[model samples]
Target: MAIELKDLAPLLLKAERTNGDVDPSVLTNVLRGGRVANDRRKELLQVIERHPVLSDRDMMYRNHDERYNFGIKKAFHYIKLLQEGGYTDPVDQQILYSAMGEPTAIEVHRSMFVPTLENQGDDKQRAKWLPLAKNYKILGAYAQTELGHGSNVQV
Candidate 1:
């Protein structure tokens, strides 16, 4: 008799977990930096998973425009949650976003644009732009064009 597809997945997962001599938690902690960091990540994930807007269900069925709109909604809600939760640490924010699975449009603003301002901008520029960028009052984009390289921007 053949196993059902639904049954096969659980059986395989259970077998894999039970058969492994190495403890899964230990490996997870190492990857996450430590047990404390892993715990923090789990806490953040719980918050994200409990939110309806962040759910990945039906995402594959969405058209490009729908997906884009949905992503913006998720990003907005996620940012609000971060502020309400008092999560100012970049690492914590990154972990929470990673749990969301898909990259949202604001990701470029958070990951690239914000960092560039902090690192490269003068004090006056940082003072002027950081607040607006961080608060999402203005969204930022980075564009790089290499001459004679067509659309490829990579060096």
Candidate 2:
């Protein structure tokens, strides 16, 4: 009798878990920064895994344009889920994105653009823009020179 590759994965994973000396939960907690964070990650992962729109299974079969459009769809659905679930914390949103295992179109907006506004924008700017960003009324993106190229204009 031959085992399918899919069937073998779980066996290998189970053996690895059983043979490991360290407790997996303890390791997970340490890696996730602590017990609270680990629990939050697990909870959000469950929500992501159960959502059809968030699944990444079909991504490999998509063309570049299809993938880009799919990413946008996933991003919108995820934001809606976050709003409905009341996941207001940025950390929770990050965990949810990590669980998705793929970058959405809005990732740069949330990760870079929003942080820039919060950090550098004046009080008046933040007062006007932060609420719009937070409420999903506006989406922002950050653009930069190619990697390894410094911000030198002459270059």
Candidate 3:
């Protein structure tokens, strides 16, 4: 089901009641351009509104695994809807980046690990490796964090 902005109204109200500062309007503006659209979007909003992390004072301080899992679950659902509706612009690098920062295997699998192989590897490599990776028959990780190399290591 696709989400219309109107369906998100009650979820916004509930969010305000529960989290106080989330401003469903923010998510509304970001995803829907302040226009209500469908039930799926509303469902996403409802989940966000009802989440225990809404009580958090700092978003970055929450458990990395938990936060990533939430973002991944939401993102996958949102991506599916956008793709089906012929709407390609709503979910972008920011959303995927947010999900990638999450510490869950699923998030890495869907957002990072998949893209890395698809974009960087050769066709033969992809054919050989992608199925295993996608099915979780083999697991992968980005273990490039450097002690002294800093963020510029990619250079």
Q: Candidate 1: where is the Cα deviation over 4 Å? A: 1-21, 144-155
Q: Cα lDDT for residue 22, model 2?
A: 99
Query: What is the alpha-carbon lDDT of model 1 when measured against the actual structure?
Result: 0.86
Per-residue lDDT of candidate 3, residues 1-155 (tens digit): 99998999999988778977666667766676454443445544454444444223244765978666665565454444334534433244233324333333355565678789999999999999987865556767666657566655554
Order of candidate numbers by TM-score, starting with the best = 1, 2, 3
For candidate 3, the per-residue lDDT at 62 reads 56
Give the alpha carbon lDDT tens digit for every residue of 1-155 in model 1: 88798988988999998898998889989998899988988998988898888756566789999998998898988889888888878788888888888889898898899999999999999999998888778889978657666865565
- Residue 8's lDDT in candidate 3: 100
lDDT of each: 0.86, 0.87, 0.56
Q: Model 2 over residues 1-155: C-alpha lDDT tens digits?
A: 89899989999999998998998788989998999988878888999899998866588899999998999899999889888999989888888888888888988888888999899999999999998998688999776666566755553
Candidates 1 and 2 compared by lDDT, better number: 2
Report the candidate with higher lDDT, 1 versus 3.
Answer: 1
